[model samples]
Target: MSISRFDKKIQTPPENPSQNDHSAPEEAAQIGAARVERVIHGGDGLLRLDGKAGFISGVLPGELVSFAVLRDRPRQFEGVLREVLDPSPHRCEPRCPLAGRCGGCDWQYCHSEYQLELKKGIVAENLRRIGKIPLERESIQILAGEPWGYRERVQIHTDHRGRPGFKARRSEEIVLLSNCPVVTEEINRFLEDAASGKILLPPGKRLVLVLADGESPDSRAVIVAPGPQTAQRSLDGLPLSFDPSSFFQANGPLLERLGRELRSRIARDAPRVLVDLYGGAGVLGALAVSGSSAFSGDLLCVEEDRRNARFIEENLLRAGLKEAQIRVVSRSAEKALAVDPVLKNLDPPSSAVILDPPRSGLSATLRRWLKKGPAARLFYVSCNSATLARDLGEILGAYLIQDVTILDFFPQTAHVEVLVELRLKG
Candidate 1:
């Protein structure tokens, strides 16, 4: 951790005190080496600088490195990794040449096992630091799949030259790529074809291609263009028709496993009513209803987006849950919860609510509502851990964390999906 370990040695002031004042030497020492203590939630290495926490990207834990300050604030500092003088044993060569440049995959430089470990640590840290929930480290289950080529749906940004790729890290400049290592083989092939002028792309439009189940490179893929294009696909055997702009889980291989896990979690509670908030395309609701017979009451799905709400309605009817009571509210979860007198008055012991919020996590209004008590069993699914921890901190008094599972939906990146089962406290 000494500053002298820097690759670029800092120059010392002259021995002759008369020639130069020692005041400048102190400032030079401040720009020296730092040792990364650990990795934080966003895949940044954490270190101490001037007695404050410093976050630097592209370095691993237990590594002595030099960095340039990117941003300075009162309590924390952000830095860009300059050199890893002493590298971590867990660090590996990134498979993709554009690993650092492309904004898609951030953790490609670390081994897959180490990546999982880092994610587990991040979850644990978030729970403890932000949620005030001290979970046993051994109890956190890490579920993983193929570390590469797991993404089924990829949105490729097109530059002015019509090349499809992703944006650079922390930049708006597009990185034109011929192939992405983390996406499915079918998607890579499509990118190659699109890049080679075999397929024509619309100018200035982002292209989203969703591969159907058991689809090959030559098979007809569901293309979601910028305009009015409706795409239909089956996720874990549930027929779903959604607009191209609608949200769906990016990882295809683990969709069935995720669905099964969710269904199992919901069935254990045997709640009478199932309320799915922020339900996109009604996938979770449909899956829960089709798999579990524990719910004899209404299965309500609340979604804010108009297109997604319509798609949820269509998907529910297509799911053929005719015997089961089903309802889709085309409104925000907060709005629906406030306006519906029945939902507002539901008893916690007999009802369950599934919250699959976006990365922003729970809204302030929803957090306040949950603080007042909502359901007996709560299934919270989150893609961002920081916000999840923040939200959990607000309502942990009324709910107990019964189960936690980490789903590696986005491999080769820092992102991971977490599912938490909460039971109402007695």
Candidate 2:
């Protein structure tokens, strides 16, 4: 389905609902049965209420749902799902008992294959509507893995009673869980042990658990708590050390595949210089420089987080790339890319830049600078499609998208990870 059609049929929530009181009600009231027309980004179902758009959660397209008005505005309304009168054919029994209560997984009720199709539509729709980049559906390759037992890392929150679980949907209240089907068996076992009093956890402290290897839950487990503790892990055969707060890919196997694909792509380009922006722990750079002679010319990693910079240094040294002329700049991508001497000296025709920005996507300063002129080849990794579309729209005039791929890093949820390769226009 075209995004423009959906946009025209459904109105978005007001930027500031308090600006006017045209549809404001003193108290929330029950809205009668509404049929969901389609699913939009962020896993919300779009429907019409009183000739205005209404967004409801825990629903699917073609389902008739009864909802309560949570917030009302002149052109839009927010609702809370009360009951599903008619369900979609793709809907199934959710594995998690707390599916709707916990904010973790939203597409559990929908079939996995259908979820993938919906995600593909979302990516295409976002690119066309927000990015102004129309792409053929067949050109967008979708890569997926086992939908369940794939999460390698998870953060558990503690409640007033010292029980560990995730927060309720859109609220601070904790939903205690004995097991999470989405996480690997190791994490589930750990959760079971913790809840059974076998594992000692202090009250009201968030805990992070990571599996060293993606496949084996028992391989090497790293625990990060609210203290001065460290752990070790290996990605694509490169040893690295990271703290609890460090950023690492949650899916181990898919991360390795992504690394291999990136390395292959970088090797084929034969760039004279490789610059990794928003480099976290320098994993991507390290992977790209592992055995490629083309990247031996120069390698630069720019990161804003001090802790991540230290980890990157330790990782590179551990990888035996000390003589590889690798420079780690501890600064933001916008600042470093703007004035870095190495970037300025690079040969744009034979150079490449790798960008893995945060969910907010590229900053305006960096986007404008890149649009002015950049390396011949650019690789962008984004977790948020909406922001990615917006950024790509601003710079597509200067660069053409050569390839686009979607990685299901997050399954059983509405989130999708996208990787796109762009070539500078002559």
Among all candidates shown, the one with the greatest lDDT: 2
lDDT of 2 by residue, 320-417 (tens): 56646678899998778668898767788888899999899999998887897579889999999999999999998889999989989988898989
**Candidate 1 lDDT over residue span 191-287, tens digit each:** 8988888877875667777765334533436464555546666766666676666677777657667777777777777777778998888877776
Candidate 2 residue runs with Cα over 4 Å from true position: 1-28, 213-218, 317-322
- How does each model score on lDDT? 0.76, 0.77
Q: What C-alpha RMSD separates each model from the true structure?
A: 6.3, 6.0
RMSD of 2: 6.0
- What are the TM-scores, per candidate, against the unseen true structure? 0.88, 0.88
| Model 1 CA deviation exceeding 4 Å by range | 1-31, 72-75, 213-222
